[model samples]
Target: MMRHLDPTRLPTLHLSRGLVVAGLLGGVATASGIALTTTSGWLIVRADEQPQIMLLLTAIVAVRTFGLARPVFRYWERLRSHDVALRDLAERRTGTYAALVPLTPARLGARGRTDVLTGVVDDLTDVVEASVRVTVPAIAALVAGVGAAALTALVDPRVGLVLAAMLLATAVVAILADRLESRSQAAVLAARAEVARVVQLTTEQADELRVIGGTGSAHDWLRAAHVRLRASVARQSRGRSLSAAAVLVITGASTLACAALASTSGADAPVRALLVLAPVATGEALGVLTDATRALARARACARRLVELLGRTPAVVDHPEVEPPSRRPRGAWDPLRRTAHAERGTQGHPLRPHGTPRLELRDLAAGWLPGRTDLGPLDLTIEPGERVAITGPNGSGKSTLLAVLARHLDPTAGRYTVDDTDVTHAPLADVRRLVAVVDDEPHVLAGTLRANLALAAPDADDQVLVDSLRRAGLGTWLDGLEHGLDSRLGTGGLGISGGERTRLAIARAIASARPVVLLDEPVAHLDHPTAEVVIADLLQGAGERSVIMVTHHHVGLDRMDRVVTMQEGVPSHGQERVPG
Candidate 1:
């Protein structure tokens, strides 16, 4: 589904027509430069021959015309290239985001999922930047190089051949530089990502690190990361530096050869002088090839990484044979006795439309890795409005179970169904839309409270938002706010406490229209009292929806309809580990 696997497929391919125009404009700019230099040389040398002033006037005019046209054409080229590049960037970002929507929280990476997503954002930017930084430059260089060779050859064949050879040598040097830099690009990228991760962790956890006396360990990590980054960058730069030197050497040789040929030729003094200077002008024009080389290498590396991540097959795909019933099953236990009453609505929804949402997992064993089941070959059913809490020790697959339920992970061996129909192979998007996940570390985005809350329910009014916040245990806090819902939060704004953050996530889940709400240790980061308050408020409004919460600690278990604790090393599926 992705074109980047070919290694040659670039985002710029879509902007071919625009890029071609930019390249042609660049060629004109470069050819004008060669013409200006050649004509200026002709005018100066011919005037020294004591020819009539009118004889030099034509050459002078040509020089002035070329000089003026160079800047005009160059400016137009820049405008066209940048416009196309930015447009391509927008499209690529949009497409990439759409592709990632289905892979979130699962394929993104198990730990530090946010960091993995952030890295992808940066990597995607780099891939698009290649259009402006790498591909456009390469196209312009090719166009300019050819224009110069053609112009010089038209004036004198021998100097033209020398110009062509110099351009060829420049191309060879650029290729060598690209190879040298490409080898270090991946290392440099990895080192940079690591360094970024360390800095993010150290800065965010400064207080915790200091309290645990792990500040020194964090500093050591930073130092090691910095060292590796420096080494990789230095190695990467070697190619560009070498290419620059080679271009200079080639320039000198070609210029000298042109001069020798010019002096021996029987051409007029004006023409001979122009030929001698053409090769020097051509060399100057091609000097920027080194930068182009570096950008190309960097872009290729970024594209390869992005393709590797985004091009993989999604974990869950829809079952083509089983279509979600046209409508929700009409009130069969609302969703309980779903043997009948399922009716197709005007809107197409997942199969088994009807009643209250029923999620059933039978012998559903799944894990992050193959051949290693972290969860059930067990059975469980969450009926409509059922409040279930799954508690277990670490590595007992609490989060793994939640992930599978949310359709983020596929079950390895069992049946997961909604409303009596197996939905293990259901459309991931449809399944996920029915579930809202509230995880441990909740993010308060850098926006107004209204903006953050509205993300979950865009069509919700202010009253609904205030109610949601109140229901999530932030009622008193909301009433106290001067700006109320308009108040800003997150970085560069008002900072919220841990309890507030957890409540905010709860409020968001409450606001979402999803029928199934999965909480993965929603209160794990909160203190005991705050946890109780949040739990009380979280369950208050979830009367009509199925809520499944996974936690290691038994917090507010009495309020839940059922509490199931997963056990480690149960030795077989369907056996709930009971402590002796």
Candidate 2:
């Protein structure tokens, strides 16, 4: 049940455990019931004279015990089977999420992540329910049916033959219906993915949809997807119903045939009469076949999806050759050490002045998808103790370039280096450790502010966090809040303003104290004065660390060490100047 175990291995374990438990409980219950029924029938037939009271009492007690144990065994089997199913589902859910971690925004887009979420949470629940409530019960029923038929064969071979034939016919019908249902379910899955895509599109375009009066179009798309899903469900339902009905009819006919055969054979005794009805018990067991078949089909489909997800290659692979810095400094170096250590300090050293450019990208071409380039194959570099501004119009690949430099996206062409080491081929974790990026749209987990900040640097002290927040202009905001850093941020921090969220994101980035930082329009949503203060703090606090700020506003450019203008798909011009 471990998350990292192979997907193909889980089902075998699940099945083995389920079968062993179910078989033990079911076999004992069936054997006891058959023995009681056979003994009672034989006693009544042989007792021509009045039977002894003790014999009657014994038979009654045996029958009562068998009847009581039936439900107990049934419940035990169901409980054990469910336990196995849930454990297997837990393993599948873990494996699916682990596989998705490295494929985000690439093999799996934002929309695809939503699909995976649905699959991991909702679809996985369905698979578990079907396995426990449907598959295992059906298996138990089949075993009971075969045992019943074999017991009857001991009494009357003709009756046993009829029951076996009926059971076989039902099995075949179940298999055919399962095929039909499988096809319908596959269609349903496709429709569900389409629905997810439409929902995501609608969410992303909520502002546009409200402005352009296109809400109805989104609704229509959703309606169409639902219709397709319903159609598939209807087809599956009809197939299963028909299969169940056929099974019922075959069972009834076999039972009736057994009765006629008993009557014609001149078995005039009550015991013999009861023997003829044994086929009815076997027939009843066939009723669960349809549910079993459907559950198996669903389980098979879920298994396939889980396998595919687990098999996907990670977008970024961290090589084992690279290692973290051995002696990371705690605070910025003195001015003399800063000058002497400029380029050499940028390579492996963690603590340097905040304003230095320790990371640089030159002629970089990168995108989420490999080989298909998006950003630039243009030259750019960041020097120690410098802040560089990157400007471009909307959709001009500003964010893409930042993501590339952050090592979230690998360059398709050209070179990107950190402290003179080519980063495109470097370990991803190493690149991440050297640089921290704060984007316009920040992700806030469902936890306290302190917890969220701690995610960036687990070992950061309270004073360090407070200092970073003050620098990001969030100190007053935190004081105004009820719990200060302990205040709980709801899911994605929904209650906070865009500006406040940006500040919190900045606080998180600064808390990391990396040598290189990337800010994507960090102050775009801030009010003028507050924006000015935060910008001043960012430029000042950057100290000797390298900083890249991507923005359209020209608020802090005059103070930057360099301003780089991006046009079309390349860096058109850059001016290196001293701060006024």
Candidate 3:
């Protein structure tokens, strides 16, 4: 029963000094309630007597003190507990985000990865919130129950024995309620996750679904998910309802027993009145245990889900030497970027073998999933200073090959070497540092224009950045910007056109100064003239640099030094280099 209530498996939990003070304050507050109830009872009985007001003074003062202390202590407890929980939540979120960096896109599902990541944040918050909801409340109830039993025993031992029996019964009810809640909690959590997934999928893919006439199917899916969520929540609430009813029944029965016992006692009337109210007060304090149990069940469910998701082995692993800090310097394009405006050469990438990196693929085989090979079992090579174009139909594994080349996917079999150094199993960080890839889909971060460009070349001065942009043909666009490099872009700022965004991505690739530049359909969205212009600018900007471009379009074939067409996963014919 206790195992189901623990949430220590959550990665982001941090225990702070405030948590202890909160629990102690909560317990003291509960004790104050019991004291207030017992003292009020004494005051009522004393007032009924034909006695002087002075005789009732102490009881009145005690009642007033307990009443005042209860709210004050409770307020302090709430403040402290929330402070600790929020701090723990912040730390946990930070650590979880850090841990997720390595597991991105590959281990995370290719579809709806954003939704899954967003849901993890909400789940982590619930687990952290349980410190206040479950732990502190249970501590308060225990303290109040113990204090009530002790006071009753001092007045009459049999009444204390009855109170203990009542507490035990309450514990039994709590355990039963927890079991019921736990049974439903997982179902509810899974339902909520499904709803989140469905909603995000519908929202993100609305256009695609509409184009394919899947709008009705998507609506049906979302509706079904919502229905299941509603049912799951209703089922979970039943346990809470049962818990509240049981607590009330126990309170009533215990109060009656306490009153009967007090009537038979030879103790003074005022003491007996105090004894009678003790059971009722204790029951009120224990009623909050239902909320504690619900919190425990919810937190446990969230933790269990996180445990399963986070436990998966990562798709990529770093080699031993580069596992801690990357072998390359932390700087962007470290050991690569040059002081000059050159995109590639000895001035760039000092680590490049003889100042030019050779990428060779010998029978490389890899896939998106296990047992499904999509690329290779064939050999290919990108020689130094070569400009190569690969043209293939859809599903010919062009993207998969690029994924392998970029170190986003590992080769399942065969050798992939860089400048004669076999890097099939090299640290991903080390391999990625030597290659620059610009795929069809580019991301524009929400930041200043300079901030967006700086990601690819952090140390690049304004002239270098401007030069790269000019080479990518963003020269006209730059001239129109009032803020120049400082212009805010993305959401509530300058909206970059598709052509401009494509040019911006090209500029980033040029500015990166990596030894090898691999472009995958860089002109996918451009018209023929724009495509020709962009491709011409690309070849001119990449003097002496190794460039491997994969494209389905045929607008700029003349500029490529060599062109190879592929069918299935293999090169259809011999690689053909254009006449000099």
Candidate 4:
């Protein structure tokens, strides 16, 4: 069962003191602009009376001061707000990534895992950016509007009432814009993700699609995705357009009202002129309302997605009452024969298993989703150091079973025990520590060869790395490298053939020295002969470790001690043992 989390409870959505201070600075900048407009109007009107030049000196200096203060305060506000937002972004990204690690490949959905990760990155950015785009402007507008109305009220009550009404109407318009933006942002986000997924799939599978005569259908999908994106964008624009039109209309009416009230009052000509220009200045300052509303809507949507993704319960749980396996010296179970150390553990000691553990599944059942069994209701067992092959077609549950064996998933029913200990009562890290997984597309990070292999056993020495590579049948390849372990392997470095890539994945497992290795279609992309050679090297390289290979092909089944054929969600046919 998955737990649902409230997105509003996330700490990232809250504003900090730094943001509030920046908003205050922004308000000062806006207030200066409004003051400049009214005072300049007064200076111009008073000059028409042909007064002495000395009478205008104070007004002239005040206008110049306001002009200079606006830009200075605005620059400071930008620096403060962006600095705060960027720091918060770093913290949020780190936290989100940590939360996602446990739910990978299972709770993240079967397909589109890459798209899910990409969306997380983009959404986190939007949530952080809202602090600057939405929060700062909203506070600035409130401060400036209130100050304008208060100052105007001291002059004449009627004109001040008109300005206050204008501010209230702008707030109403902002609310309407926010409602409209909220209604369309989700559609726009979905349309954009569809377009991206379509383009990426089409480009990456171009050759396969062409061979299977799916190119036309692929193009049709791309075209449909583009059409949806355009429609969503068109709908999203309505809110911005409405806010702009409403602001302009409201400003014109308010200016007329202020002018009428001022003209009938007993105030002088200069004072009346100043009163008329106040509404016009305030309208320009509030023009940022539309952009701020849009940011708020988009940020809310991004936050919702993040919460939904991170709140799901992990497929496997580590029971708090269960303690991790106690440490034992290498070869403790069979002291008659000394086993060579594999990976270095804490403080440079080896973390090798005492001996290989037996695995048994008794009518086990499991699924990626609730109420849908993808595997089992069958019995199976593997003795120490045995090699087995699970042969099945797609949807026959081979991969799901492997996920259970690797401790990446929890079984829904029945019992699974490792060396007579039930897996559910064992700590997750304890079971996972004994297993290594090698898949078809093993990621080759763009770095040095040593760095890539060190991901499995960070404390292993160069000699250990060389030994593992040699065992995987890469001794000749390593000798040819100019820099030995320092040789780079991924993009912009050295290119690897399909056979070499499979061997490298095997080498990583060998270096880790876990007691069991689960290979899920490790040679799915390789040709017949290449697949055979890779499998031979992998099995040989694993040494005494138990090996379980899941595949539909019969390329290397002849070497397995047992072969189990599965149908639907359980093993159906009698198992076969072939002579090695």
Clashes of each: 15, 17, 2, 0
Which sections of candidate 2 miss by over 4 Å?
1-14, 26-67, 109-111, 120-135, 264-284, 306-310, 318-357, 368-371, 383-394, 435-567, 572-580
Ranking by lDDT: 4, 3, 1, 2
Q: For candidate 4, lDDT tens digit of each residue in 1-580?
A: 2223343345435678999999999999999999999999999999998899999999999999999999999999999999999888887777777678778678887336447867998888998899999899988988888888889889888888888998899989999999999999999998988987898788868888999999999999999999999999998897689888999999999999999999998899999999999999998888888789889899988888788888878888877776444544554452112233433432233234455778999989999898999998978898888899999889999999899999888899999899878888877777887788998778787899999899886867887788889888899999999999999988889999878888888888888767788999999888999889888988887777889999989989998999988898898888788776
Per-candidate TM equals 0.80, 0.74, 0.74, 0.79
Best-to-worst order by TM-score is 1, 4, 3, 2
Q: Which stretches of candidate 1 lie over 4 Å from their true place?
A: 1-15, 36-68, 109-115, 200-208, 266-273, 324-356, 425-427, 443-455, 458-504, 523-536, 541-543, 552-562, 569-580
Query: What are the Cα lDDT values of the candidates?
Result: 0.76, 0.69, 0.79, 0.85
TM-score of 2: 0.74
Over 1-580, each residue of candidate 3 has an lDDT whose tens digit, in order, gives 1112222356323345787778789989999999998889888887898699989889888988999999999999999999888767787777666566556556766436655666687778788888888778877888789878987898899899988988899999999988999999989987888888888788867888999999999999999999999999998888789889999999899888888989999888999999889988899999988888887888888888676666556667765554343445576443322233343432332223345577889888888788988877758898887888888999887877777777777788988888676664455666777677887767787898889889898987777788778878889999999999999999878998767888888788777766678899988877888889888888777656788899999867888889878778778889888775
lDDT by residue for model 1 (1-580), tens: 3322232243423447887788778878887887788789988888888987877777888888999999999999899988977776677777777677766656665325545667767777777666666666667667777877787788778888998898889888988988988888899998888888888889878888999999999999999999999998898777667789899999999989988988888888888888888877777778877887677777778777777667656667766764454544654222222221122122212123243588888888987766787887768888787788887778888888888888888888888898775665454556766787899888788999999998886866777677778778788999888899989898877899989998999888877646778998898767888888788888886546688898877687877887787776122244232332
C-alpha lDDT of residue 35 in model 3? 90
Better structure of 1 and 4 per lDDT: 4
Indicate the TM-score of model 4.
0.79
Q: In model 2, how large is the Cα lDDT of residue 57? A: 72
Q: lDDT tens digits, residues 148-241, model 2?
A: 7787787778887887888789878988988987887777777778888888778867878989999999899889988988888888788888
Q: After superposition, how far is residue 425 of candidate 1 from its true place, in Å?
A: 6.2
In model 3, what lDDT does residue 394 have?
Answer: 92
> What is the Cα root-mean-square deviation between model 3 and the actual structure?
6.4
